[model samples]
Target: MRYHRLTPAAAVLAVLTLSATACSTKSGTGTDTAGSDGVKTGPGVTETTITLGALTDLTGPYASLGRSIVNAQQLYADQLNASGGVCGRTVRITVKDHGYDVQKAVTAFTETEPNVAALSQVVGSPVVSSLQQEIEAKHLLTLPMAWASSLLGNEYLQVIGSTYDIDMVNGVEFVVRKAKLKPGDKIGHVYFEGEFGENALAGAKYAAKQHRLSIVEQKIKPTDQDLTAQVTALKQAGVKAVLISAGPKQTAALVGTAAAQGFAVPVLSNSPGFAPQLLATPVAPAVEKQLHVVSPAPSFSSDIPAIQKLAKDYKAKYPKALLDSGVIGGWNAIAVLGEDLKAACKAKDLTRDGIAAAHRKQSGLSILGVSHDFSDRAKPSTYESFVHKPSKQAAGGLVNVEPAHAVPAARSYPLPKS
Candidate 1:
């Protein structure tokens, strides 16, 4: 596993405080009651403290992404607590650093068992895969950051955003339609070798087929410092478009290399490939002129009421850090968790069973503009999973392309040729 030392100042602060509460239970009428089996019996929970855990990459290679999510989760928790919490009870979040390692993620899961009612924001695909069985065995509901299609059928996991493959397809389709590219247009892809990369490649292939275009070249690797070779390959193939599905560092390298090679094809990126820091790096000027990214939410600079409020509050609290999409996604995840807890605590008995039951019955909960209605039939569905595109706005801001779309399932798009 890769290790990156976390500056002590970047450490997360944990706030834990307990409050005593008492309330009379409604008599009879099939109300919930505590049973010998440790399950609460009732219509649902009334007031109860629910402990949620976040295993994030607070001090690892994905630190930038993970830290923003941690801050957003805390912000949501603070907002909920300020509003009297859910169902008269307070919600507490326990955060642990997985260091972006699969093994450490497993260890973090074991360590957090005591307070883990649900796990939110598990940051990497390998880590999520490692914990899949454990999560199901413990009956722990999980909200994952990784978007591998392998996670699609899991009963214990609820993916809350567009998966990698879907994002690529939507992004490519939008660019093709908007650019009016015709058949025989050549497209290229540069991606990593694992699930993250494969998912993007799959989407590109699918889109190419649907539009009767061709993938002129494909470059795959496990890791690289410079993508000069990949860029050279794409350039030689005479491709008119390129799709990249790598992390921020590699993405920066690709953009810089592509620019240096004088390859100016329209470049589309997966979610992580669009980190603001990457755009702010020295290579940003070139990227700004040539890069386009598919976003899962409105751009960070959107004036939409929800984003505006979040940005204002975040800046007020963390003046040094620029608000980014990952942070907003984290906030959304926590908001949904708060809503689930709220629904769970509406009954007389505040217990695990009651909370789960409440979540199972959730309907019409809104977060920002997205509406989530989970029922017994949709127990593992996520609250926000649509695909959005972020383009530069005239006033020096990023905004989502109008008419954002969603892919309800992995197969929603045509499968790529093997």
Candidate 2:
């Protein structure tokens, strides 16, 4: 759904209406109450239902990912509800399209904060950063879609898997091992200019230092689509391999432009840098040949039973939907929330504090065979990551080159101080 630019009055009115309809509750300071079941109830919890809010980007830079994420979450919630949801209450998701805008995200949060148990999904680093203070002030447990390392150390924010820095560290390690680079070798890193890119660059820098390699940097904005100049500069630098901390468009442009220019070298990227739809583009051959993405989730083509079931169920639900890692990400995030809710239910405390405490106690949470430990808020759930390369025949247009694992360097890399 396309969202046109709205006038201030219209935007406020729209958000109010959207929040009221989506929440189906009166707005006020969200508080908890005792339910008949002896469970502590909260603003988004009632006798029969529990609601979660999602601030996603459906008409912006990450729309492709946002759509799939929402679809998978809704699918998971529907299935859970059908099977009798946690603590005898049904699960509901109320989503707002922020279009990756900071103000829109803050507005959505303001309008919806009083009506949901927690935020199920908030896409983009900027959006997450913008809402951090509010989330902390309200003590709302939130799962962010982005993996910027800067989001770490927040008690209210649940970063799903390995952070951007760890992903880049693993990515650089993978590229180094694959390319057999020696000391003094140079690698080029093309990145964006914000939390995501800067954090990933830190990882790359750390990994390079560990391997005794030099880095050539090319920083760009998210709106910088065509990476011809970046590619050209990297190629001129005579780097042995290139790493990307940008989006799919920049990934495609870099790989395709490099191939066309005959700047043949391994290209590594963070997870969010690839999309299955790119397989249909003219850069398919180049992407398949050169691009490798480090992902927290397994590919849709993975043979894991749970993942296979998810792929089958997702296909059955949305026949025309493009298979991508976003679906798995969304499903995993909601599953994590489900775990927290179940714990809260078992403890007979369904308030925001209850949920947040429950999450801290959660450990060994598995999705796609990766164990997530929520005991540490200063670090990611895991340090391991799957390395994938594009393939036309793969269900998500990418297949794992190797099983997910954390390298020695990644294991020892320290997170940057906030």
Candidate 3:
């Protein structure tokens, strides 16, 4: 859902029909059986291979990120399979594109659920929200690419990094310090109207209250790409800085319009709000000069040993693909899942519930130099985040501007339960 994408009514009907066909013809037996190692195997977990599902947006608003994420996981699976995959079984991913539509995402999930042991990637906040109940009911371990706080508290849906609220709280603190915003100073927040934006806004509001700053709120829809009017309003409000919890297109629009209107100010955004390719656009100048992003993972060009290796392998495999931050996010989620599967294997139980249990037992996990704590299902994997700014010469067009750490404000802010 990247919140949501607009689709023609006809396309929705067509996808629904296609989903029905997939449901009838593509459904796997999903039967449980005993493995040679005496492991209890379930659907998608066979004697020779374990299949995972990826419900991603390949041709929608978040298509660029979706493709990047999918490709990285594919590369990881390839390497894992080559090196003897989890529990001596090869890993396979069955991917389905939902085009970022809620109904289509539901349809895709229903079609794909029967054939997979776990969901390796569900790419949108709203899409994951739509599937949470079924994920829990089935005891299916799922990794959501989205970081919405609302998606937390679900044991089945293991969010990979800092939740939207935590990232935003840290992001707000970064901006406040960089922009020298004193108490009573105002900042504008432009966000989509959904779980993703609202959750990030929660962090912003909390931080604002804590710092004695004021917030100018502008709520928009995912389909609303042009943010000229919103930019005008923030400028008129005379805000010191702007925080964005929307998509890349909206980010470009807001920053570009702000530049065109001469409303120069620091603009900070949630991770998904920026894409590397935007640096090639007319807004590149403004994006580079004014926009900063808070990411849950390392940049593609990061010099961290694991990240450098991933970058090398990813570039070798996908020579034509843009170096994207989603690759890191994708790899992180899959690596964590792989660890859980390994734990399940050691326990001689590869059932869906077994994998879920193994996930709950994981703590102090590290990937790409970020430590994750999954011991608490009610909390995010980590509060640490990397601050990034546009860099034309950097891979993914971004470079880390600050070290990864949870700011004091974020550490003290209470996470919203809703």
Candidate 4:
């Protein structure tokens, strides 16, 4: 929790020049680190190597995501080590599979924490929830992939993008404001029963209340694949638009099932709901017509100079892999990690505490548009998001409808109970 202001020259590499505006920041500021070389100052760090950890799900329901996150983290580390790693120390990452289970995640964290400096990517919200206490107790500065708004105030927590709750709010705002929800109309929500689903529900509920629209809810188990009953009920309920908080398979299933059942309503889904592979499936046309996604950044095809450079690098390294949300997200997470790592190294504090300190000072330095409008580390979250309409013409089948921005009442939305 301690921080020191970086010198101007150091700030150029570590801190992006923030403009004239009020914003959220990492942590409090102080002076430069004054530690000698050859002394043990942080965990998983030594004169020659720095070890990192990742808790992932390689054989579980969300295995695709877990694989993508690890691949990207390793890609980043490989590139760095090849070019002479941070502070002249080579980087190494240890990956542990939790299979998306809470108990498994805890066990993996318990074993991996002792051998690593930080956890680069923790995949599931519920899993992160399970490890939250131990992470704080150990002060392991973790940059998690799951964007649950509920994890906000934790000492070592840093989200990759906006939370699921925020993304949900953005989706709702798009329907109510731009898509034009009407009076006497209702919005229906179907979600898996977990932190991801609950956070998304919280956002949908907030938006519906604020817009004076009637809302109905349905919760589902992750194992229950057939959504015929849920879709039928929503159709019977006469809901106008549906919000889904589930994965790619369920997303396609619900939309496909709804289409087959003649309930042709638009679906607005949470970020994780869609993947590039959906476009190649049998339900491609239905998906293009009925689905829309909320995301933290522009799609992988974004022409931004930084993304272009990254895409180029990825193509050179792994030619056969198709660029999906997971791939882009993996690269993005590590890009941010690489920046903070360099900053931590420059500050001469490569230990767990020093890394946390460096993250505390990250203000406005986005690693090539991966994150925008970031201000402070302590409040490492944003209420802004963008809506992408499913498009048959676009490569990923989703086109931007609204530029990423803040909802009018976003800040007023209440934080969920601890």
Scored by TM-score, the top model is 2
TM-score, candidate 2, is 0.93
Rank candidates by TM-score, best first.
2, 3, 4, 1
Evaluate residue 190 in candidate 4 and report its C-alpha lDDT on the 0 to 100 scale. 89
In Å, residue 144's CA in model 4 sits off its true spot by 1.5
lDDT of 3 by residue, 170-208 (tens): 898899899999999999999999888999999999989
Q: Per-residue alpha-carbon lDDT of model 1 for 8-28, expressed as tens digits?
A: 343444331212122233312
- Whose TM-score is higher: candidate 1's or candidate 2's? 2
What shift in Å separates residue 291 of candidate 3 from its native position after superposition?
0.9
Error of 3 at 86 (Å): 1.7
Q: Model 2 over residues 28-116: C-alpha lDDT tens digits?
A: 43556888899997778888888899998877767767777888888888889899998999888888889889999989888788888
* Angstrom error at residue 322, model 3: 0.4
Clashes of each: 7, 0, 0, 13
Query: lDDT per model, in order?
Result: 0.64, 0.84, 0.84, 0.71
Question: Which consecutive 10 residues in model 1 have the weakest lDDT in total?
Answer: 15-24
Candidate 1 has a TM-score of 0.83
